[model samples]
Target chain A: MRYAGPAGMDLEKMAVPLENICSQCDYKGTPDCREPECLMGFARRVLSYAVQKGLLDVPGASSLIPKGDFKHYYPEALVPALAETCRQCKECRDNHTPDCVVALVRSSVEYTVLSDSIPYPGSVFMYLARIKEQNPELAALLAGELSKKG
Target chain B: MGDGIFRQKNGMVAIDIVASCGVMTPEQLSGLARLSEECGVFRIKLSTRQTLVAVLDEKGAGRLVESLPGLGLKVSPYGNVVRAVKACAGSSALCPRAVGEALALGIEIQDKYLGMEVPKDFKIAVAGCLRGCTDPYCADLGIVSSGREVFDVSIGGFGGSSKPLHGEVVARRIKREDVFLLIDHVLNRFRALGEPGEKLGRAITRLGLTPFLPPAGVKEAQQAPPDDFVKFLED
Candidate 1:
């Protein structure tokens, strides 16, 4: 459940601004939506992940409905994805569908990164356990990572 | 002027990217190609570690470095650091005995230890199975998976020894869940107990490997994969 996080990060202080920033966002639920490339947004992304997984709920998001790409945040989106369906495949012509293998890999990467930032065992499991049913590979990875940190 | 910058013979700098473990997206590869063409850098080599041996002039390196985080690439130190985990044809459908995902585990190791100071050059390799395709036994720290949820962890088997020792297993039939914990504990112990600049195996040879195991013993380390790890692989 526990993992290493970025050094010198103030998780408690960052939580407030992160929730504030995401509450004002219009693109919060877009499928595989990336955090805008910046420090503040990155922290907000992790907090948003926490809130969505019922790990931590920011006070403001209680009012909004769960709309937009619902599958984007769960293992439901990883089942059909395969390495054969990579998004960056030079040879592949089909440009539709969320089954990109690379996207799945990226999600695994994001999951590991997010877990690392959370800094606790129960919390990391909170993320990995959520996706255990939909994608076992990520769960294995999360365990491996948690062990590494310990 | 930089700590990690390497001077090259071709009026270029060699920036070592040890964390990639040789996988890259087509878009990332294309972006690199464009960068090369634009900068006129002569060569890009994938080194033995399956990392980029990218050679670029100083100016070109600055440009490339700025864009690297965007592409999810990092340049880590080359020597006396925990080198990137060299993975083989394990963890995927390729190897029949895959008890673990070598790339995923390798990336985890890379993320945690890359460029961290070590006593001396340290090489690590992970194999999903015991076929030794990645030469785990020949590395400073070699890990070989032995079961659906078990791994064999060893230390000190570099080929350079006149009589190179096979990586002596510090812990055998370890649970996949505990592999990382064992590795972390063993490495930290090695750092503390080893002589200055000593290789991990040599240090283990002198101190004996018993002190590195979990207090509960190696037997405790063997178990089924975690529920999620199993589901990911089968369900």
Candidate 2:
């Protein structure tokens, strides 16, 4: 089924390596069973390839898997696995579950940071400094306070 | 209607009246509406199901309740008492899946819990089948028909400002004899551990079903009870 509004963007066109896509495809009936390291092996290789090609920014990426006593990250495993299969496929946009998760998280983060009025790190502080520079009385007070400060 | 003599913090002690279920008639309603006007109760709020709720000042509330029996109504709300129940017009009226009588069972449960206090508000909804036209899953306790004279009893369902979760069936194919006993078990269990302001669904979720189970080797306690409404029509 086609999702009309904001979900019209095609995600599968992003592309995954051919070898990785072949192994990840569940052609056999035992998709839910433990296939030793076959599934995880394919996932790790695909993620490495994406990072090496600079297609995915690893330093900025959030930790997809949780730490501690839990054995498996049941839902998070879907991220790389889905990204691999959807690579270069126009039909990726048709899949509701995976695409919706990424879209919602991105939208939420943007809404939280950009929509706030208070100053933040980097560019915002620079803008505040320029405003203070325009006000000579405030600037003199800051200069005197800095000279007298402990 | 006479002037009131006492007042309470919540409002005024306008009236106190009691009557059996099914005892009120149309003639009584007409008389009460007039008495309510005389007592100064200007409006009556019809509940979600089929119950009349009147809000009046102290004098009017007292007079309405006093004259209620003559008009065939009652004034009862609050406490752990089983309040009015909601049910859909079943097969007898206009539903296809009404194998069991929904309205009759609803009335039976209402009478059984009438005037009895529990730990919190207990709601009972009876639907002819799983279509849930009357919103069975929205009640704290619910009964949905599976077949003729057969029903699945569900517990811990509720609906309001927050979304409601559908209940799980603890028993199935319940016969009429065990209906009241099942209700008694649930009510007594709730009364034992339920804290003030906690609704029946919240209490059940907190305590779980282990406490409500029958003790080992008790034959009658082994199975869940049937709903009385279906039994009434079967008989």
Candidate 3:
């Protein structure tokens, strides 16, 4: 599964350590077979597994949280669904897994909740336009100067 | 950090240093331009080799060179660091005839030699193939691909201000493992007796290619047929 995000989405949090699964594979003790490429592939496979179970959120969604605080802004309903998925996945086992998808989702969700409390993008632009509108006298003087140059 | 900053005191000598070819990123160039302008520089020139040379009266030169790398662009004008290994934008991004990644290898050479002081400034170039979009004769060392996984490494080539013609084949159909070592040997020999301020081609002319020939057991020096040279990179 491909996880995509805009900001505040950390790829490191979704990654699992390859050493945990090394003992389970036949190539564990072989010097020739223990290549860096092979280890990197195993790590990628674990990420894919987490994505397949719908346990990870896309990267950009985490930025939706307000002020970097999750409790203040994330939707309440999404929290329980994320927790349930985390509890059911065996990939989240402490010893076998380096990272779990649930923890990542919870952190993202909390971030989103906090972000929701900030001013919307359009509102800031609107405020700037209002200030320009309020200064009509200064605007008229600037216009007069332009007309004189013309 | 020196007091002697190269700048145009009278502002009449409008010198424009251009960077034509190199591995510099766009942001790095933009920052360089801004910094140069701030230092009362006349103009920043971009060379055909993708290198950025800022033209200042001798005063601003020090500060510009010192600051550019912080923005990710390092000045490697005349000292070691594989002096501007030129490579065409090949099949990795563009170009239909490219059989292998010329830019990738060029980048590898650049990273490996970025700041290493050599006997003289050594230049290596990579072209997608014989089309020579990069003008193979212009580099001190040139690598042009023949086919899948094969490359032709040319030596004693150069271009731009005071152009010098490239010389005969030192090696042909070189594999990846041999390329780096071969280049290292070439550079090491050049550095051993290269006179200060002497260009690589000039140094080779003074020393002669016979002394730099590959060691015994390696293929003897012979003029490779154009077609055999074409497959040099593929083997």
On TM-score, the leading prediction is 1
Instruction: For each candidate in the order shown, give its overall lDDT on alpha carbons.
Output: 0.55, 0.48, 0.49
* Fnat for every candidate: 0.00, 0.00, 0.00
**How many pairs in model 3 have backbone atoms within 3 A of each other, for residues 3 or more apart or on separate chains, i.e. clashes?**
46
Candidate 2, residues A23-139: lDDT per residue as tens digits?
444542465422222333223332343333322211111222111211232222233333322222223222222112232222122222222212212232342354255544433
- The ten-residue window of minimal lDDT in model 2 chain B covers B217-226
Q: What are the C-alpha RMSDs, in order, of all predicted structures?
A: 18.8, 20.1, 22.8
Evaluate model 1: give its lDDT.
0.55
* DockQ of candidate 3 against the true complex: 0.01
Chain A TM-score of prediction number 2: 0.18
Give the per-residue lDDT of model 1 (tens digit) for B1-235. Answer: 1235689776788876643567788988887778776766668888777788778778778877777777677775666767777887565444422545666776677677666667777788888755567888898888876554567777887867686777877777776667777767777887778777788878877888777655464463434423432222222
Model 3 chain A lowest lDDT segment of ten: A92-101
Cα lDDT tens digits for candidate 2, B83-193: 666776554444422545666777677766755677676777788755676787777777776544556677777787475667666666565445556677877887888
- The worst-scoring run of ten residues by lDDT in candidate 1 chain A lies at A57-66
